[model samples]
Target: MFSSLFKRDDTFYTLLEASAAEARNCAILLKDVMTHMGADTSSQLDAIHQSRRKHKRLTQEVTERLCKTFITPLDREDIEHLSSALHKIPKTVEKIAERLALCPVQYANDIVSRQINLLDLGTVEVVNMVGALRKKAGMEHIQDMQDRLQHIEGDGDKMLMDLLRQLYNGKADPIEVLILKDLYELLERAIDRCRDAGNVVFQVVLKYS
Candidate 1:
């Protein structure tokens, strides 16, 4: 499974790793914006957007490789599906960062921080799962990481509920409520992107294992 996937170096694996790294970077940038909401984060937000664009290019390369190359490290449809899934993690994170940039600093709190932290963990797991294709990792290894990603996503969901509980407590400003709710949902969706990508990696491994 491992040797056939990439021989530790190839265009598909290389591009997948690059896209996964960008996804991880976008997750971290989103965390930074939440941690420093009071400060100017125009540069950091711009970087998040760039990561999304970079992933788009990588995905396009995967499609081009599919057309030009005689064979792929994995099935063509699997490569396309995984590439598309990997790109969504950073793409969704970009949206979350945009929402946070406009949100008031007074609303930022431990819950949002913990949620973003989980999001970071999720993307990191995604990077690990993708890299496993080139690392000769056992099926158990990737599956374990996939399980962890799912756990992180579940934690994010719990935090979302807790945030809703706070927002609906009736003492908060209506406008603040709407903004934070939007931000919370976006963060959860970002976490979902990671879990979804990890699932794709897991399925691919299962096919070749």
Candidate 2:
């Protein structure tokens, strides 16, 4: 009976994966929003918000499970930290979506699209990293994945700087410049959130390995 009762709740990994998937969904939706900036993208924005909320619920479940369970697949703190990191990705993506909805159509240029693509790639990688936790992959493998996220985040930082440099060239409209700057920073942040989640997973592997 005790074996059945204490069957090692692995559902925490599942919930974390679901949260990571939601983060990826937000990135995908953000891409769609970028492509259709001139069109009414309220629906896409709504979808991103919904994904963030879903991730929030997953985070809550993780916390609740931590409260009820004595044993876990990972350190309790690692699980909580990872859950928080994953939740932030979608939350940040939702902010990006909101900003994109309000951004001027003319500013939805190729650079913005490239940045969003980078964001999407980062979130996808984050999902992979979280899922690998359940598989108990080797530290080297998880570190490789984490290193990719670091590179993606570095690229995002460079892209943001490039965008800012262009915006500050003194020829652009001041108001639009301000709006674009805010959006670009938010994109950078979302990518960083993915990197942060990767770092958490890599640390967890290091602990167990």
Candidate 3:
């Protein structure tokens, strides 16, 4: 009976780990979507959509399990918050992909790709921070991760401004300009989601630590 009780105690940690892994997978999918932005095939977009569906299902399953189980590895609220935040990562990625699919923008430059890469890096850091939650790392390391995410968000903001300026000032066609502008906005929102994820991790650390 004691061993069975111990296993139940570990279930919440396993759920958290799964959520973190899903976030990382979403990040990779978003990177691929950005990389293939100008490609002739829509395979990447399809793949991201599928991944988002899987993430949604996993999050729901974990949430249901959270409600059914009496014992959890951490606060019930923390598990719920973390699960919701992690699930949003892929949803944002899916939204970006959907926008890209509909937008007629043909990017002549690599600005979107560069911004997405930065966001992916920031996301990886956030995932690391979330994983550290299971181990209950020092407050200092969690703060550092939050700081890095903030810096990344700043970079994304700067890049978005520069891209907008170039789009309006350059001799590109009006329709092309509009398309690129919307695409940049979507990419910016994706980065914002990454920062939001980092914030969620920070809250978890602050609450439990």
Candidate 4:
């Protein structure tokens, strides 16, 4: 236990921060796609894919570093768990982009935009939480961020229900309904992925608190 003090490595924190930034970048790309519906989104989609690749590479780096290093600032399993959780955010965001690009609908409504906004907010909080790890931030602060994530997730669920209700009301064509529902659920899942990462952060803080 005494050696832990002098053996601390800050590289994990750097990798985690880079991963979180990628997640935020992915969210920003998704928001851009939503705001500029009907415009050429290939560039944005490519950007998301790039962010996803960067994040995946970061996650692998974290794992490889963990294997090589004898001591880590945090628990090995915790670092691995958090890295995996952070990777999911970009992966899900990429899926959302693919779904949107393939969607026949040329425009999005308030619901879609609102969902993307919530996702953006959630990713911002995630970036904050990951940064906090560098300082060994307090449990209360981490919990506060987790609460915000939970609220965003709740809002996402409600918004999805409202959207489905509109789709089920029977005015829209069946094909449109199918596409919209899939896209909506994908967006919600992306938000949920953020919530999952927050939960891992909360648990890590709780353990070391």
Candidate 5:
């Protein structure tokens, strides 16, 4: 009876993991979209659309579970915040794909590639952080993952700055400049969304530690 009183459900953790997985899926699709710079992006956009739908479903599951569960492992507010952050990632990635599809740019550099790599890496860390909630999570371990997310976000900022500098160097076509600028900003925002999710996990660990 005593053990039952302290028993915690793993459903919340599973839902969070599913949401993180969707974010990773979105990143993968975004990376694929970047690889085929001038090719048709319809398939990639469809994949991201599917990923966004999956994420939305998982988030809704979490919300509905929250309403039913009397005792959650984590605070209600933290769960909602993290769910919202995870959803934003794929949503932003979908927007990026849509923009690229509307106005395809032929770039000759690896700036976008580097950003996609960082965004994917950051999403991976977010996944790890979310999974940590299932185990006897160590504050130090969670901090390490959070640190990785922060590093990715910082690198994204530096990369965007350098890319923008090149864009304004009066060499590339003005139309290309406009398209790349929009895509770069969206990618950076996606990375920020990853960071936001990581921070929520970190805060939850801190609160429960």
Candidate 6:
């Protein structure tokens, strides 16, 4: 019975790892989209769309497997909630990518790049937290990560508001202002989703620990 339980635990961890990989890929795709601001966005959007689809499929598989298995590594509800939150990461990224494709703007300003970098860092930290989920007692690091994510997200919000105000007040072309507004909003949304991911991880750690 002990051996059987260990096998079940390994299977659950494997599923969680797969989900984390998908989330990481989504983050990378978002970074690529920001890096190639003026380049052809068609390919980047396609890549993000594909990643989102794959994440959805993997999430479904994990859920179905959890339902069928007699033993689970964590509480059944925790498994369900974790899987749902993991699925949202990619979906949220895809939404931003789609909006970006619609509003094509070449950002000469560095604010976009900085915001994307912060978002990527937050995603990386959250991914690390997800990996440590199996060890409930090792979740002390999650609180630190959550705090960092919140801080970065707050910074992003402030930067976005400042830039928006400058754009509205400055002598930039109206069309340019519109494009930057949309882009800034999308970038802020991405950062917000990363915070949401952190919150979900925090809940998981709290419930289990």
Q: Could you give candidate 2's per-residue lDDT for residues 67-171 as a string of tens digits?
A: 888778888899989988888888888888888898889888888888899998998889899999999888888888888889999999999998899999999
Per-residue error (Å), model 3, residue 62 = 2.0
lDDT of each: 0.86, 0.88, 0.76, 0.88, 0.86, 0.77
Q: Each candidate's TM vs. the true structure?
A: 0.91, 0.95, 0.85, 0.93, 0.91, 0.83
| Model 6 lDDT-worst window of ten | 1-10
lDDT of 3 by residue, 44-116 (tens): 7777777777777778888887767777777778778878877777777777677766655455356767877
lDDT of 2: 0.88
Per-residue lDDT for 1-209 in model 1, tens only?
54544442268889999989988988888877777688898988888888788889988998887777655778779888889998888888888888888887888877888888998899889999999987768899988998899899988988899889988999988998898899889889989988899998999999988
Please list all clashing residue pairs in model 6, or write none if there are none.
none
Q: Write the per-residue lDDT of candidate 4 for residues 45-146, one digit (tens) a residue.
A: 888888888898999999988877777889999999999999999999999888777765554777787898999999998999989988889988888898
Worst 10 residues of 3 by lDDT: 1-10
In candidate 3, how many Å is residue 29 off? 2.8
**Worst lDDT window (10 residues) for model 2?**
1-10
lDDT at 165, model 2: 91
Model 5 TM-score, all chains together: 0.91
Comparing 3 with 5 on TM-score, the higher-scoring candidate is 5
Candidate 1: the clashing residue pairs are none
- After the best TM-score superposition of candidate 4, give how far the Cα of residue 164 lies from its true spot, in angstroms: 1.4
lDDT of 6 by residue, 15-112 (tens): 77678778878888987887666678888888988888888888888888775777787777777877877777787778767665665555446776
Q: What are the clashing pairs of model 5?
A: none
* Sequence-dependent TM-score of model 6: 0.83
